[model samples]
Target: MAEPFWLVRPRHDGGSDYVRFLPSQEAVEVREGSHLPPQMPLLKRRQWLPLKEAEDCRRHLQQEGGFRSSEPLF
Candidate 1:
């Protein structure tokens, strides 16, 4: 069986709903009558990227062009 079955709970205005993940089966289940909250965002699979990849992307961006959005950009 796959490990680390996560349950995504959407937090909204005043309530929350749950969405479960079955990693072993690669399935996702949305509960009934569970309305999506406005405050909570819908997370995509791409959003759950590895830290190494994120760091690599950051490094690449830094190399391409350092943070220039600020007045005293580095």
Candidate 2:
């Protein structure tokens, strides 16, 4: 089996910055804050790839590119 690729989006919830990762480019509801499961592996800022690179990964994985919000939702 292959390791899953995730599209990470940076978000802020009134106080701190948190990231939401959409696994395999799926359009799922993102959970807010720093309450992610401890079992989930996290990538350091230096280990994170660029958006274009992520897009390429999505193509290689044959996953759909989900919608991207340009403007702030707040």
Instruction: Please tell me which predicted candidate would have the highest lDDT against the true structure.
Output: 2
List model 1 lDDT by residue over 1-74, tens digit each.
Answer: 13332232334455433322223233323222233445444434333334444444434544563321112100
Clashing pairs in 1: none
> Mind giving the per-residue lDDT tens digits that candidate 2 earns over 1-74?
12333333333532222333343333322322322343343334333345556445445434443323223222
Cα lDDT for residue 51, candidate 2: 53
Poorest 10 consecutive residues by lDDT, candidate 2: 27-36
Model 2 spans > 4 angstroms off: 1-47, 63-74
Residue pairs with colliding backbones in model 2 are none
Estimate the TM-score of every prediction.
0.26, 0.24
